[model samples]
Target chain A: MMCENQPGALIKMDLGSLTQTAHDPIHLLPCEIQYDGHAAVDKYFTPTICQGVSAKEVSFRGRPLKGQEIKIPAGYIGLVVEENHRPCSEEEGRTVCMKSTFLSFTQWNLETLPSADDCAMMSLMWPKISEAIHRPVDSEE
Target chain B: MELEKFERNNWGSCRLSSLVPPLCRNQHCCLGIDEAGRGPVLGPMVYGICFCPLSNKQDLEELKVADSKTLSEAERERLFEKLDSLKEYLGWALQILSPNVISTSMQQRVKYNLNALSHDTAIALIQYALDSGVQLREVFVDTVGPAEKYQEKLKQRFPELEITVKPKADSLFPIVSAASICAKVARDRAVKSWKFLEDLGDVNLDYGSGYPNDPKTKEWLARNLDPVFGYPQFVRFSWSTAQTIVDSRAVPVRWDDCDGDEKSSSKGSQSMLSFFARKKDDTKHQPHRFFQERKLETVKDL
Candidate 1:
């Protein structure tokens, strides 16, 4: 959503929260993420999944997999799909890249998922920590 | 309140707040008004009014308030702070007369304007104090011109409150002196801020000391002598010396043929030369006449 003093009328969503919910195997086959605004269409797969695969080894819809690297950890599926078929210009200038590595994968079980109370407590405590980090220092004598 | 004790000494003491009859009785707040830089050859004339409650009469008396000239600058500054901090009120009004105004207005007329301005400023301050919840009954001013004239002016402006005017009131009354200090300090600050001599090179003048005999002041005048520079905006150009300086710097071609006019115009230029001339003329006639008369009397006796 938009708020006063925000530079542009765009909403920023965190990919980390979506990745945690998608890690469960019994969660659902493919969940649809519906939002108000546009999204990217390119599907991205983690580098670990494409490690030993060569170009033309995997193909989908008569097109060979490009074996492109994904910056996120393995088993985390992330992609941007636009609701409209509008073309967008590529982002220009300097950019910072982030990398995440998965050490191991635990068995996904829906019964072992966090309770609603635990999830609520984590959400509430996370903001308090973030607020404490962003608060200004009092310099008055 | 009593003048008996102070009569024996040249410098007297009195309660400043109690001088005004209404204030002494604690009926209402009293405001004393006075001005500075009226007779100065330079600087703007500043008028100031100070108000205080009758209860603090003793505190004001303890400070020994006197005319600004009588007190040292440090002492004036100290009392200034104390008066400012005390339960009192103060207001200031300033009028900067250019050399042109001074050159045009008669001396008496200038005094009238200054007195009228001071009375107006006092009334304004009194009204301000009243509006701020102060109950004021009277205002006292050290008269700059005739007491009757200032009294008339004050009455016209503030018909509701009582007004008192007296000669040398700053010396006779303590409150007037406090007002004098306030006016003087304010006027001095104004003069300091002015850029009268900014365009004139090399000559440094400080408020002209408000005195005519200052040498540095005379030098400043001599240096800034052009139609464009004119008389300094702060100076009282009505004074004869201002005109004389301006005339002295006039183009030589204009009065070059008239030596007599030049000499007369240069009158009062050298204080020492005039003094010696007067001394020589006095001794030449009186001493010789007495000696000749004595010699004739002796010859007649023989």
Candidate 2:
């Protein structure tokens, strides 16, 4: 795909196929609702309108995102964390999902996601699958 | 707990214990014990045992057991596999002591020295085989340590079985040689597939034989010396070679010998005015052989 700067205010872009198979089934789209320069973010997911478009050669405007948010989110944090070490709003202060985090999936969530009682009887046998990859070499101490 | 269903706990760490297969009844049974990786600076030192009915002596002899050092690795492995398949007639066991355990046992902090550790492991394997109901009348061991003391220890453990803890017994006894091959094969596989948990970055790890004299092992140690953490755990840190490399690479930590005891006694308070005053205990001595009062004997132009 190629990105070309066109005359006036339009940018011409080409989208092509990315891979042979194993395409991502999920895509997130951004929507903006504005009052002057202030924009209200509506917590809503959009249904796919263009189903057959190949998601290759997407033109990124301005700078690409620094993918920090994926690793550590900026959402609600636990109270157990120390104040100095806890993830804080150092940049723009409205607490957005701790950049990439914020989703509630705690040890407490284990009670709901797949509770111990809800798991199959074979759940305890998981270790049989996790054999040691490398046994230590002999040491003549 | 999720761990309750598992038959054993240490499916994860190195196996330094015995695993004796059940022996078939009938045919006078005897056993041979030998070790591999004893002097190597890498991998677990393995003690292997081949116990079979007296009838299978010819079968073990047919395997053409010799000092594992003489056999090629592929040859040793082939023989090991054949011995493994004959479990119905022959029962074998191994005590795989991981490098960590070996290092731990030999390190400065632990005083259970290598000979004792090796002896204990060998004895444990024999005991395990005996407990597994294998009728073992005689046992032959290939040992580097003093055989008399080793034989005594084994005899004390199993008073009925005839025990011969002879150096180079692997050369004399075909069964012991077979055990030696088993040990050597296990050691080879272990060293070949040793995994480092840490991301070693670009360090090449094709160390040859894991022996101290191997230049490749030395090179790998030199290449992988982490400035702060030293070598990876696969290295026997207690081995002098590894210890020397790690110590040389490390920041020399010369800790002063601690002389103070735990007691903290308070001294009696002294008068603050004592600081300015001369002590009564001060004694003065006359200067001997001094050129006092500026008196000088001048010798002119002699």
Best candidate, DockQ: 2
Recovered share of real interface contacts in candidate 2: 0.00
Index of the highest-TM-score prediction: 2
Cα error of candidate 1 at position B38, Å: 0.7
lDDT of 2 by residue, B98-186 (tens): 66556645542226688888888888888877677788898999875788988888899899998888888998888899788877887
RMSD of each: 40.1, 25.6
For candidate 2, the iRMS in Å is 36.4
Candidate 1: which stretches are off by over 4 Å? A1-141, B1-27, B87-133, B206-208, B251-302
lDDT of 1 by residue, B1-302 (tens): 12222222101111112222233234456667777777777755655666666565466777888888788778777777666555433332223333323333333211435445455555565565566555667677788778998788778877887888888888866777887887676556555555432234444554257666777777776765544223433456556566577545633222112356678877848676566564555444343443343332221110
> In model 2, what lDDT does residue B269 have?
55
Error of 2 at B18 (Å): 11
- In candidate 1 the C-alpha lDDT for residue B60 amounts to 70
DockQ of each: 0.00, 0.01
Error of 2 at B300 (Å): 66
